[model samples]
Target: MQQHNDTIDSAASADEPDQIHEPRLWRDKGWTARVIKNEDGEGWAVEMIRDGSAEPALVGPWTMGRNKVDPKPLDATAHQTLVKTASEVIRRHEQQLHAQLNKEVSIDFGDDVVSVRLTITPDEFEPFGTLIALNPLGDVLATTNVRPDFRLTRESAGRWAADGFGKIR
Candidate 1:
């Protein structure tokens, strides 16, 4: 009987919206900072969670409260710091992914040098890549559909250019 009553109480609470301890420190749009108790029983830890994201974008140590016994409350200065750090983390991740998906190589074709690029477009339904050739003046010469994992190498680019931008064997 006790277990059944407890389950009913939890189910009722689950229907209610999330109740934050301090409403002023959190925002519905953009990113929000929350100060939580550390599991190590030491100090506090801050988590910066972006709106619509399931997990926190960044989490790190936080300062202690004035009495040095409890976790410090969230403040404007601390929230700003967390937002800056989380933004940098997201920026670096985007740059690394772009570098991995986009590749470029230069190959000598007789007297002129040609630039070959392989760009991968990752889509949930159908992922594909585009193999493009550009002249010295950065003008597109040819384009072809390629495998998403295509690699642009000097030998491969040379063969593609020599064959007039046909499918690579």
Candidate 2:
């Protein structure tokens, strides 16, 4: 839960000064932490993300962060590990998308062709909107959506156009 930019002790109810043994890498405005009280009045470790991004940033099996054996709250070590893991996860996702775009899927829209060439775009959110399509001779024929019509064959540009490829959005 987002408790306004703070990572609280999962096992401790009161904010008894966070025995900060080490510094955290993700100490940003978008990150937070909270202590989750379990049914047995136990505490569970959980992180919060209020950046309004795709996923909620949470940490731990919650109560598992606390040792049934130790009952200690989350620490610097665990938080650092969490940061690394989350960063790697997002990096892998972008890498996979780059691989997909660069893999080159040829679209046969009759005389027209579409190629999903990978472009080094600015580091930003997920890329969307229509991208241009160029031919082997570098000629512009039609502007289709990022996705091609699966039914359109290279030999059927006229048909694809008639069915609506270059129609102005």
Candidate 3:
């Protein structure tokens, strides 16, 4: 029993993380890229994220090898090159997003449709997580911190659909 426990602990704290068919990050601080393949095999895409970005800073389609086939799986040698290419892609995307969201969206909410943008601000100080979402017109629709585990997008959409605020099902 003691030996088995030790082995489990060592494996849990292993220096390397095992990733197969799933993207893995070599390091957290520097540039990181995840290779994702289309389910239909139409094409491949690389989601590149850099330091200080909340989400993937850049995303673009990937090319195939000369044989007109998918490039080989990700490995040490290929990973090194990917880092360089992905970084440049992100540098370009950052410039684009910066130019896109120049100002807040103009909301036009009607009786049948509610056109609003919810900006969720999370409070991490308290024990129970708290998040406040404000609409583009600066309206507070709902406020809740009761449940720690909650999804904003799905829940909000479902509620709107159920309440007949969204398109009828």
Off by over 4 Å in 1: 1-25, 39-43, 66-69
Which lDDT tens digits does candidate 2 get at residues 63-97? 44333643345565555566666566667877886
**Separate clash counts for every candidate:** 0, 10, 0
Better of 1 and 2 by TM-score: 1
Candidate 3, superposed: residue stretches over 4 Å from native: 1-29, 39-41, 63-71, 90-169
TM-score of each: 0.75, 0.42, 0.31
lDDT of 1 by residue, 1-169 (tens): 9999999968865764452336235432367888777777777778888878889888788778789977777665666677789989989989999998899999998888999999999988889889999999999989998888777899989989889888764
Better of 1 and 3 by lDDT: 1
Better of 1 and 3 by TM-score: 1
In model 1, pairs of residues that clash are none
TM-score of 1: 0.75
| Model 2 lowest lDDT segment of ten | 18-27
Top candidate, metric lDDT: 1
